[model samples]
Target: MRPLSTATLLCMSLIVPSLSQAEPRPANMVYLRTVDPTIEQDIRYATAHNFTGHPLDGYEAPQCLLSLDAAQALARVQASLKAQGYGLKVFDCYRPARAVADMGRFATQPGDPRKAEFYPRVDKQDFWHLGYVAKVSNHSRGNTVDLTLIGPQGLPADTWSPAASQADCAAPYGQRWHDGAVDMGTGFDCFDERAHTDSQAITATAQQNRERLTEALKKEGFVGYSKEWWHFTYAGDGAQKAVMDFPITAP
Candidate 1:
């Protein structure tokens, strides 16, 4: 083969660096909406409607990205629930590693503007010890998700604003902030024992709702976290193990 000319070699150098600098999303990861548009998504971290009172790092868009395997499994769960006049709604999925670090920083910080509605009874510093937040989250691996069940009887979710009234997360279903989801003992991200998956402190109706959601997800190889009723991690084949830090972006 002939030796490359000077201009050809220069052009090759520029192309090589550009390609090397690119950090395209892995082929195995995908947005959940593409997998199942019917499933509802209310990605809280993408907005300031979460425990942190601010959007975490790497969440540029409110989209549910997950491992293809986990997304497929969740879609199956959504399908099964639809037959029973129910649907799945996700709060978070595929959290970036930087977001996890942001959570850690939030726990140590002084501000807790949203504490009344998210973690009313727990101290922000105790979030890690109480198992409400993790230093290394499985969500970064793209197989875990925080979700809730929506049914015909659920009250309409009120639009949250900075001026909205703050209600304790553990308050009775009707008295608390209505997230348009069935009562599961406590609201999402409630750092209290009432949010425990098998806690008996809740009403029978709430217990039944938790069980229904748990069983539906379990059938698809997703395992629930005992501490947080809304948290589940997919443990089936093709589940990702390495943590990912890709920024959540608008498609």
Candidate 2:
């Protein structure tokens, strides 16, 4: 809620100037740590939603867009979780605007069979109209994050099963163990109505799983998105800024 302190601001100024253009982080550094009730809240909500994915450990900067303030905010949220027996597990962070811009590289439509190997559900059809994702993500602002909650062990139950590969959020949890690394009822970025944060169409067990995540996230401040139950952004009182094109890369 409060703006970056004078001390943090000075530190950020020093760090930002020293970084340089480089390749994507080793699929690891993409996740950064930060504190925001929103992120915790998001994780709790995910547990309820039935997220089974693991938290990512780093982030990617937009090709050209950067937000040091947002990065600090994220670190704050991570710190808060460490205080409560939880650690922030990230998925994707600081998406480079260039990556977003390069969306065209894929099928102009998300459903183009050419890319079906990449996106299994829905199709190239929803990218623009359906809002599966966009050319300009607020994540480029460094103010958004993609993550899920871990258990007391700092790890979640193995949501994957032999059947996990075919499981959908709406499937019966009793009939099958949770699938995917996230605690949410479905997989991350799963494009389906059942993936909605709260969908009656899902089995009772799946619904309960989602509720678990929601309750936890609410305690923190991260609110869930109605469309994609697994997606939540730590949008505090910060101003909405321009999108960046910095790609996620590591040293």
Candidate 3:
């Protein structure tokens, strides 16, 4: 319930310098680390470890960029969770429009090199149809984030183990993607019904973890995506901002 610090407020101001303008100014986007360096970030698109099996465009570096307001809100969420012996670990934030476009393109022309790991039951061409990929993502608006909770040990409960079998997202522990995130039924961007926020198929423990993440984020006005437990959006003015195409790089 604490208010954003003056420093965070000042940083937020820099994220959207032209609120009066009709179109959003991409340059106004600020790196999340600048607002709160203590938060952990693992921007997946900057590397080849994601579902794409390769680095997407417009992700020049591993960075978490967000609108000022969103960053400020997330910082608050992080503080609240930290007090509860949990913390936030971001996967993606403020995606560039070009990267979203790249995802769409990948959907059309792809073999499934990573299918066994990411979307084994789904076809590549069906990604758009299944709502696994969005033509226009909320992330491009700079207010959405894909994240998970770090436990009291300062890391996710599960860790990626290359030796683990590749199983459906809803599969039991050691059978699903080992992304080291707190067990939330499925891995981040699992593209499965099990990833749904309220899915009852997962174990009670996963459900509790998901709810814990939801409550922490909700405390700061971040809304969880019903389809993706790890995804959340700050429904602030930044939600209405124009989508951006800037690369995510260190500021």
Candidate 4:
């Protein structure tokens, strides 16, 4: 057979691979090692509890960025804040497409044992009915994450606890985004309108803190999702990493 044209090859390259592999993503992708102490404290706190937690089996995976360049840049930003004693703790990075599938399947019955520990409050069957997942997710893009900040002592002083559905995004400051970190009215996974970065229903403190975090993230090349207070991205870069698969144990 004749060789494919360069344009055709490039177009084929756009096709994303499935996730849930031992090593995911291209080497050109950036990844910054976790160096911020405060970030460490925060993750330790979550690990201690089951909040927005990662199952123990997936622990060895390097918490990385799609591109190593992005990683180093983010690391520098975290380092600069070290003197103030706060740092970034990543909840997820470079998600495998297979893992995304896992989430979709789990979403269908969120209350399952694997689902229960991470989201005990959710009903399990309502995930599809909720906006939490579509056949395709931006998270598959590899720039999105589901994490929160930590206090000086570690542990989420106020983290967004999960609700069974996106409808739960409203109600109130359901979890807690206060205790030294910027307030964003709702916690990380609020899943509702009130959780919006610009929601009027939030407290003045929450709004102010949200703005502060937004500004800081912007300075470091990230942008907030607006609908979810805890969500943000480096902007203009996530589409390159989208893959389809379930995130789970791989041999």
Candidate 5:
């Protein structure tokens, strides 16, 4: 065979991905409902209810898919909360790597309809620098989750209004959209320092609710992100696993 020219080799390399460069497909992921039906789920990225104001890529259904280990840990957290007239309501879990890329793409675009509710204070271009959006998220590993607590009525006591006054993510509860989730200082995916897990700027009631959630997840081996009260990562082998690109299809 004749030796291929360097230019030809480079072109071929660009056209075909090497097997070594391909990410590994993970096994044993499960929908959260399979392990614990009591846990409530919003799965925001799968619906138009998220920061993007549109369904994200790779989320085919509104489902809380997660690594088995992470799901089980979440189940334990649910059990603990249930006894106290509270239940877990997850916003996101087991995000696909493609979805992370989608988030980055959306941030670059102009005209976000939901910006007032999710990121009113921070500009979209600053998302990466502010850690509001990431190129690589722990969620792709199927071990991270964004969640909150639901009250005994199984309803969010949100005081939602499109005309609600706009405030920074750190603004106290009623100032933002009445996101049905329990008042955790800010709305889900609220991109602000006020959303910081340990922020002392929130009301005493909101602070208590935030601590309650953190303590519940902590007992199950999950660690809350300092910047987002709703974000948690399972600290185990799952966190070290390869990021996934599987869609959240219905079982």
Candidate 6:
């Protein structure tokens, strides 16, 4: 083979830097919509509707990206729920490691714009101690998700504005901000005991709804966190071991 000319080598150097700068998503990761377009996604961290009241780092878009295994399993769960006149609506999936750091910073910092609604009963500094926020999240492994169940009579989700009226996350289902999901005792990211998976403090209907969601996810190898009914981690094969930092980009 002939040695490359000076111009050819110079051009190659220029192209190499640009190519290396673009970080490609891991091959094992996939957007959940491609697996099941019917599964609704409301990626909270990509927007200001979450507890932080600001879009977190590394969330460039509101999309559900999960491990291929988890995505397929969730699709199967969705199919089962659809047959029963219910569906899965995911709030978050495949969170980047940077987002976890952002959450940690929020917990320690001095801002409470969303405190009235998301963590009214608890202090922000207590989020980590109470298990509401994790320094290292399983979601960064791409096999965990936060979601809710949507049933036939589910109300339309209200658009959240910074100026919207705030309600306690543990408020009665009808009184709290609706996310078009079935009543599961408390709203997503609620930092109260009532949000516990087996909390008996909630209404019987909410208890039943939690159980239904739990059973469905359990059947598909998802294990629910006792502290949050909406959180589940896929424990089946192909679950990612290493946490990822890939940005959640637009499709």
- Per-residue lDDT, model 1, residue 30, is 96
Please identify model 4 stretches exceeding 4 Å from their true place.
Answer: 1-25, 29-31, 34-38, 41-65, 79-86, 110-130, 150-182, 236-239, 242-251
Clashes of 5: 1
**Model 6: per-residue lDDT, tens digit, 1-251?**
99999999999888775646756689999999999999998999999998999999999999999999999999999988898999999999999998999999999899798999998879999888889889899999999999999997677899888777398889999999999998889999998999999899999999988988999999999999999999999999788999888899987
lDDT for model 2: 0.48
TM-score of 5: 0.83
TM-score to true structure, per model: 0.91, 0.56, 0.83, 0.59, 0.83, 0.91
Tens digit of per-residue lDDT, candidate 1, span 76-133 = 9999999999999999999999999999999998998898898888899888788877
> In model 1, what are the clashing residue pairs, if there are any?
none
TM-score-based ranking, best first? 6, 1, 5, 3, 4, 2
Q: Which ten contiguous residues of candidate 6 have the minimum total lDDT?
A: 15-24
Better of 2 and 4 by lDDT: 4
Q: How are the candidates ranked when ordered by lDDT, highest leading?
A: 1, 6, 5, 3, 4, 2
Question: lDDT tens string, model 2, 147-200?
Answer: 555545322344433234344434443332332233455555566677777677
- Name the better of 1 and 2 by lDDT: 1
**Candidate 6 runs further than 4 Å off:** 1-23
Candidate 2: where is the Cα deviation over 4 Å?
A: 1-88, 109-121, 152-183, 215-221
Q: Candidate 4 residues 1-251, lDDT tens each? A: 99999998888666754344335446455444433333432222223232223333333343544444445545655665564565565655555555556556655543343333333354546545655445665555655544444335433444434443232223344343333343446544544567667889878866765665566566767666765676666564433554633232212
Q: Whole-model lDDT, candidate 4?
A: 0.49
* Candidate 1 residue-wise lDDT at 239: 96
Candidate 5 local lDDT, 1-251, one digit each (tens): 99999999999999986867755446678888999998977787987766787889988888998888999889999999889988888889988888999999998998787776688778899998888899999999888999987874323444433344344445555555555666777778888788898888877878888889999999988998888999999995555477788667888
Model 3 agreement with the true structure over 40-147: per-residue lDDT tens digits: 887878876677877889888899988888898999988888788878889999888889999998898846656766777778888887778999999998899999
